[model samples]
Target: MIARLGDTEQTLDLPPGYTLVALRELGDAFAHAREIAAEAGAGTLVWVRRYDLVEFAVVLEPDEPLASARRAFFAGMNALADAIAAHCPPEREVAFDWPDAIRFDAGLLGGGRLAWPNDCAEDEVPSWLVFGVILRAAAMAHVPEVQAASGVSLLSEGFEMVETDAIIESFSRHLMTAFDRWKERGFEAIARDYLERLPQRKAGERRGIDVNGDLLVRLAAGNAAPERNSLVDALARASWYDPQARGPKFE
Candidate 1:
């Protein structure tokens, strides 16, 4: 069913059990979702209607501790990538840059973000967690030529007439599937799926997600110590996002 909020009309076909909260173009889905996360409960999806970008955040109530629950971020990323891949052209490749950046081929296509209460400790089960994603749906005409050229959008990447609503709907379905897989198989399955999409930085290198969601990388050659990339540290700042532009980084 469609929902109308303010002046925007929602055309999302989300799976059963999702509650829609549509926002106008100027609204911030991430922040809004966080504001209502506790009261809104899980399955609440906040979506911002914008022509040039696909922005949305979903509220989740996890049964696990905050440390491991953060791994839900990877599930969200996998869902986003799966949604994009369903419409992506044959030659285009979708990949993740460590914790939070989504890349289309070699260009940035935006990414995901995770949020929880500031008071929540690693061992504590947070009241709520929000997983948000933003992708450049189309290139803005007024953006500087240099910046436009450096960033990638669905339109620029040869996606034909793909609507913003369609992407969000697709994401909703994929997200449900991701969580289902996690419940049945475990977070390790989700980690494996996410790692498969990540581009290999070097030959003979292996990557895995730790119990606390940190990234573990080691060379296949020997017993050398695996380099640990803390998920908490990596998420502190999104690598693909530009704070000033409030979107994907162009460079």
Candidate 2:
């Protein structure tokens, strides 16, 4: 069942026993979904009502533990980036800033987040996982002068015709494609797709994903030391997301 909070029309595509809820712009999809994820089960998509930002979260029931399943966030982020790039103006650059931030022409747009049951251990099944995402469709209204230089919007960046529904639809399809690639071609294929979206560094620098999902960068100076940041720990603290403002921080 689809529930509407305010003008927001959030729909849940439940596969029989699941329930869906929609919230207004004031609603926190990630926190709300995570709060009731256990009972909501799978197939729950909670979305917020915001024209300037495409905000939503999905619920998943994975068979793996939290640590391994967290990598799944990368799959979602990759697909989310792909969805944005599809409609991006040709030659417009889009790259990821480390683990969880997406940038367009070096400007902050939006990013994704993850959540699970509080008591669930890294080795235990958390019951359900919530993969949340947001996109800056348009610039916010009347921002402070100092903050103006930091934030950006798709409209300002030449993505004029994009819409919230279109992004969400494309994201769902791309996410499924990500999963298929992960299953058929293997995680390496998924990693390659994600890595390709990242902006290239200096000439001759190479990048690869380690087994644990840390970004391994190989510089041209004959340096092979891998930048081994744990994916699980990194995701725990989203660098781009600002909880107080309910959006990304442009620094």
Candidate 3:
């Protein structure tokens, strides 16, 4: 049962269980969601209304400890990629840059971020988790033409007539599907989906996600141990985001 907070002209057709909290164009969906995540509980979605960006955040309550629960970030990334693939133009491709950055045809697109309570310990169950996403829907007039070309947007990538709302709506459904897969299959299933979107750096390199969300990489022919890439460090800052620009980086 998706419910709207107060009557508003803008609405989202989210999945049956989501609760909607719409924000103004200048609102920060991610920040607001984190502030109210405890009382909001799971399935609370906060969306920002903007013409040039697709921004939203969803609240979740994980059953497992914080260490393993961070794997849910992969689930969110998979759903974000899947949602873009659903509306992508033919011949265009969507891929990820390791832990967080998203790319379109090798150009930088926006990415997802995860947040939990400051006091939550690795072995303790977090009271709540928030997964937030921001994608460049259209090129902003304020951005310099040269800089704008360095990054990709839905409109720039030939996604004709794709409304920002459409992407968020699709994401809601895909996220539910992803969580369902986690319930029925396992976290490995979600990890597989995420790895599939990541571009391989070497021909014989194999990649896997660790129990605590670190990326494990190994050469197929080597007897050496797998190299571990820390998820915690990578997620500390979103590679694609430019804080000064307040959006995805242009390079």
Candidate 2 per-residue lDDT over residues 20-81, each given as its tens digit: 56787678888888887888888677877676677888888877877677777789988888
Ranking by TM-score: 1, 3, 2
Where does candidate 3 clash, by residue pair? Answer: 1-16
The local distance difference test score of each candidate is 0.89, 0.76, 0.89
Mind giving the per-residue lDDT tens digits that candidate 3 earns over 83-197? Answer: 8888888777889998998898998889999999999999999999999999998886689988787778888887765456788899999999999999999988999999999
Cα lDDT of candidate 1 equals: 0.89
After superposition, the stretches of candidate 3 with alpha carbons farther than 4 Å from their true spots are: 1-8
Please tell me which predicted candidate would have the highest TM-score against the true structure: 1
lDDT of 2: 0.76
lDDT of 1 by residue, 27-98 (tens): 899999999999999999999888888899999999999999999999999999999888888877899999
Worst 10 residues of 1 by lDDT: 1-10
